[model samples]
Target chain A: MQEIPRQTEFVEVRGRKVQWTRGGSGPDLIYLHSAGGETEWTSFHNRLAQHFTLHIPAHPGFALSTGLETIRDIQDMAWHYVDLFEQMGWCEVPVVGFSLGGWIALEMAILRPHLIARALLVAPAGVRVPEWPYAELFIDNLDALRRLLFYDPEHPAIPQALPTSLDDPRMLNWLRAREATARVGWNPYLHNPKLPDHLDRIRCPIRILWGREDRLIPPAYAQWLAERLPAAEAVQFESCGHMLPFEQEEAFCQQVTQFCR
Target chain B: MQFFAFHLMPWDRLPDDFEQRYETAWTWIPNSLYEPGHGGTLYNRYLDELVLADRLGFDGVCVNEHHQSAYGLMPSPNLMAAILARQTQNVKIAVVGNALPLYNPPTRVAEEYAMIDTISGGRLIAGLVVGGGPEYYSFTMNPTWARSMFREALDLILRAWTEPGPFEHYGEHWKLKYVNPWPRPIQQPHPPVWIPGAGSKETIEFVAQRRFAYMGIPYFHIDFFKKNFDAFREACERNGYTASPSQLGWLVPIYVAETDEQAWAEYEPHLWYFTRKLLKGLVVLPPGYTSARSAATIHRALGKFLSSAQTRQDIEEGAYAIVGSPQTVRDRLTELAKWLGVGNLLGLFQLATLPADLTRKNMTLFAREVMPQVRASLAESGL
Candidate 1:
């Protein structure tokens, strides 16, 4: 696959300049990033770009985004993205979201079903299950967090992105991302109490992907989510953890591409 | 200097292999481990210590809130304050404090504080705190909203106490139709507000702006306390007010005996237990507990302190605690008080599993032998 030349740009959405990346040319495929903040364009983005024009926006509070002050909850973030779609002139785009972003994608689907033509939620975390609670990302130390997110801690592709120093910019960005996540997903814990009730409202076709070895949110949650949604399928990837995109990059992109097609 | 006898009221009867078995003493520690009969005795004994402190002429008896933890038994400090109000006379019953944000309407805090104040006949120092990071996990609270909720809840509490009731409160975090607290506080305006902080600049500013007494958290090194006190004083100066010594309080763990060697021999094990065992793997700050700037500052400061004090000798040299004979304790405290310029001293005599008799004796000795000398020294220095 030829590498897609990606360019980072700021798009003004509801008085906030949202930083986003764009590349490739085809059907609009909006990418939502996980809680660790937006990653550098990888082989996943490269492959996806060949099929669809990838519109990946750094979630409001991550990196250089300016919407942290305005976004209060996941619902607010859903609405912000809704406005982003309209402002960017994207109509009925296929949305692919990872982890925290997957939760946001679900919210978007519920809020405005028409906006998301198709949805692929990879290891999503927004459903309240009493038996299996989401692993606490906020409380875990950096090393523990990495272990929770990856199937193999020694994987070469797995970024060794621990904070170099207390004042490291990367550290600050990580903290900001976690802060943003807490702002949205703190009460009732990373899940909307009413999400299950409103699952039927999402008319768009949905694919819930989960890593078989996912420790952060159990694979059982994906099954539970698939059961709730009106039009949904749950697929589990073997030998992968919470970070499906990074762990099984080619397979994740292929699954997303197939679902979108 | 004013002295406060503070009790953590810890459940100290952990099995010998507790450190090896449990990851932490807080949050996820099994409830099955808590023996109710033992807990009952511990509570009674702890309360007895506080009452004894009152009888011994300690200025205040402080109780704090911690949930689902062997670290502190008092989940409801206000409840403890209410009991202390009736039992102890003369001593200020300081519920230091109710975690402001944890209360839903926050008027609950207002009503409870007022009730305690009324019962205590105005001898209440209302210590408002943005509960620690571990508390957010234990209470299942959002750390991002902790500061905002604290500010909003504080505003609501103050209004509920001072403003004529039946006033509607429509804030971002809480919406209340009628915040009409029945019993207003006995203190004319309100009780003296003391806020405990772990040297966050924002907290220092917030506390200093209101001229509330800023109580330094006891866990950090003496140098950290000095730096934080200086920062607080600077914050006060920036607010165009010269901070009085009374505006600052230091929470210190102290153990006094007839001889320095005796004090160290007895206190060392308990202090080590409190520091190493009960507090192991407990620095879990819920994301967004502090702003990025504050967190960075804390991390930087903590890194330096932790690096320096990896050994017991380093900890002792840092003066994290004062354990000595009455004269030695008094001299050390006097030096600290003079250097830090803190008028209020919150002494934790009853630490993790320190037996009731020893706690009582330590309190008695400090009050009788050491307290007068410290006070006299401060007075002579015109502090």
Candidate 2:
């Protein structure tokens, strides 16, 4: 069967224009990318788009979207997403996030809990586990990324190197976006102590899926979260790492679909 | 239900004028040093209060570990456990946690835990943890290996308890031959292991099925604790067992003063130090070290929390320790316990920067005026 292209569109969010794409049709689902923006061409996103009307946005300041000057933090990003949802007339949509995107989705749940129908956070961050430091991703260090994100170093699925060279212009733009996003919200980075307070207010069902071997954010956090969020469920993917959506895409997409349905 | 208290030795004795002369004097110091009149002296008195807890008919007194952070001065909780062991006669001494992965020879944990267990006459609750992200950077361990090392260390400690005497422990992270923990714990099969988490899904499941008590250190707020308790309950149900609230414990920063208004007023400065100063630079997410769930969880805590003007007040309201009158505290604790379905309450009366006198007052009030009624109410309800 021929693969369907994701229907592309754009909307103004928080004073910046954001490019979003969609494909298939069912319940509305929003996809937020990690530090690395939308990789819709990848088979994982394509498959996700096949089942749900996947609305993946190139988060402001990321590639294909105008850089955001006023967007100061993840909450800014979260509020912008709420605006996007309002603009798209998505009163209640299941939102899925990965890595940094997961952080944004969590923020979205906290900031605009009413807008979400259901949510999934893959390889998310935020729970303060003892001494589990996030690896330094800057300075062209994929080795640190490999060691930090993967549970097993020998796991065949982890890309041995960056999918594309860092110097590549396309890769450069993505890196710049990552840095800009990090700079605005970098100091404390991916957590709100108040979030634990606001979590109970998130009326929708929330599922936090963790890769057992994820080094960036340990699975232990899921346990921490499972304890705190009342309407929350947590599942651990033993064979996966931080990149659960991509590392174990088929299983991930299937689980999400099943949960959303 | 168990009751406990904490004192993070914040030194207050150093001359205020000393800072004018020396650049380093004004620099942030560890919580261990006793301040001349208030910080350190009060801590010793706080120790006396723990002894008083034993006298006041409370069940336990708790302490914990932290390093380089003024927030928690007890770098070696084992040491505090020893002090409490010698001073207090009857109350259980819970070293609520020791950072496991930070220690080498994992046997050190096995040894220390055993020592504390024996010293306390088998009254010890060994809390093992991976020591959060900041401790990882402080101890210079690869955040990537923290979970495996932490879990392995836990396994080794558990094995040391059950496996007869000196045996080989072969672990991918830790390789120890003839692994023997001397003075094997006074409590057979090890002192009860309780896991503490700010929030972690892995911790809840691990502690729940094992029937080990799970502690939620929701430092600031009570709201999210409901979710943690709920998740813990669900995990229990999934395992075909109903989790009683008694199976869970929660740590709250509590201060009980003469009046509710006085308590909040007295607690303001210390609480600010606890939230802002001590927490500054403490938030570090280096990347690639946590599981998928962690990275996807909370992206930034400080910036998000402190973005607006009322941030400080918001944090204070959320803090488990804001000072309140005895009746108010009792009411809050009662409501919180029933809300979270928790039986054991670990009250952190002494914070990193709170004066000793203030801390002691908080404890003494809780013990003398507040606790009896709280217990009576729970007993009355058969909760």
Candidate 3:
């Protein structure tokens, strides 16, 4: 398959330059990145873009996106995304969110029910099941975190997706992204305490996707989260961890493409 | 020329295989390892040692904070400082201090510190710190906002001490309708501020800009201290002033005994317990705990540091701790103190597993035999 080139776009959201990427030709699909904000438009992105217009926006305080200090919490982040989308004239779009980004997507679907037509949440962080709490990603060493994040730490795509050493230029990006995650999720530890009670407000059809091997947040919790929401279903893929999108790239693109469509 | 006795109040016991069994002494270390029954006796013994330091004529006795760690028992240094303020007369009570950002309304720090300053009868050396990386983990504090929160907290505390009450504080991290703290610090213009750093350029600059005393946090190679002290002096120079010796302090663990050989036999195991076990994983910098530049500086300095001093020779050479006879300790301390150009010496008299009696003996022997000689030597050298 020939590579489909992506175009970069920027819009000022609340006075901070919010950057995103656009490619392919189809319905607009908002793609939210995980804690280690995705900087590269990888193969999975390209695969998804083949079927849908992928709008990958880096969260505030990650990579080229600015204005982390402007927002206080994940709710604020959801609002920031709303502002970004409104400024870019994107409304009532399908949203696919990964990990921390999935939490934001869920928050948006609940907070502004009309803005998201459907939501695909991949290992989202905002709802906690006491039996399977999110891993303490902030404190764990990199090697251990990698093992927790991926089913196969030696996967070929991992070197590009994750940082191995402080010497790597991507170290700063990882650090900044984790810092932002901590700012929002550190206290409740990736979950908003009240989010579980309010999960019923999200009217859009939602998919809670998880990897069977997720050690970060136990895979069983995906069904647990799905059971709480009004119109949500749980999906689990094999041979992947918390980083299901990258670890099972082909399956993820196919799943996301199918769900969002 | 000033000796301040410092105590980390380390847990008096950890299993001999603590290092092998546990990856870190902080945060997630199983709390079951800690013995509740032994805690009271340990706390009382640690307090008695600091009191003994005061009776032995030390200028100050210091207590600092740590959280969820077997490394140090004092999660609230202010509580210990308040006890010392009343229990020990004539010694300055230094709470080196409360981790600024962890305090909900930083006025809590202002109120508590003021109470300590007042309790100590104006003898308080307030040491502000951007807490440890482990603290960021333990407290769930956003490491990225650490410095900003620290700076803002310091400003709020200073304003609470200096400015009049009912003032509105509309800051980024903290917003208050009215900021008023009663029983303001007894020290005019607040207590002497001491900021501790481990060779972070931004920290040194922050200390220099305010003309606050800069304390070198311990356990690095002696060369690390040299580089940091030089950077500090250079920072002061940039601020259009030469940093006085009083503006610099070096914290080093010190032990004294009847002979050099006896000192080593007495102190070696405890020093190992400290470095190998207590300090393990203490330097794990949380994400965005500091600026990237400062993190790099710390990494470079750490590359030179003996993380867990490999040998007695490494310990001696790095001056990670000074253990010797009265004569040997006096000579080495005077030489290093002058060489480092520091006016203050915060000596850790009671480190990990040093018994109460031995700690008292070390403090007494140092005060009686070592401190006077070192002070005289420094004075003779016009330091």
| Interface RMSD, every prediction, one decimal place | 1.6, 10.4, 2.3
Which of the two, 1 or 2, has more DockQ?
1
Chain A TM per candidate, in order of listing: 0.94, 0.89, 0.96
User: What TM-score does prediction 2 earn?
Assistant: 0.57
Candidate 1 chain A lowest-lDDT run of ten: A159-168
Task: Quote the lDDT for A61 in model 1.
Answer: 80
Best by TM-score: 1
Report clash pairs, candidate 3. none
Give stretches of model 1 more than 4 Å off.
Answer: A1-4, A24-27, A160-168, A227-231, B304-312
Query: What TM-score would you give candidate 3 relative to the actual structure?
Result: 0.94
The C-alpha TM-scores of every prediction are 0.95, 0.57, 0.94
The total of clashing pairs for model 2 equals: 68
lDDT of 3 at A35: 90
TM-score, chain A, candidate 1 = 0.94
Off by over 4 Å in 3: A7-10, A24-27, B173-180, B380-382
Per-candidate DockQ vs. reference: 0.70, 0.02, 0.47
Top-lDDT candidate index: 3
Task: Please write out the lDDT profile of model 3 over residues B6-84, one tens digit for every residue.
Answer: 9898886789998898999998788898999898888898898888888899999999999999999989999999898
Please give, for residues B211-239, the per-residue lDDT of candidate 2 as tens digits: 87788854525556777789999999988
Tens digit of per-residue lDDT, candidate 1, span B1-383: 79999988997987778889988888889999999999889888889999999999999989999888888888899888999999999999888899998887788898899899999899999989899788898888878889989999998898888999899989989888988998999997999999999888889999999989999977677888999999999999999999999999998889999898899888878887787667765566678888877787777666544224454576567777888899889889999899999999999998897898899999999999999888988988766
Candidate 3: CAPRI quality band = acceptable
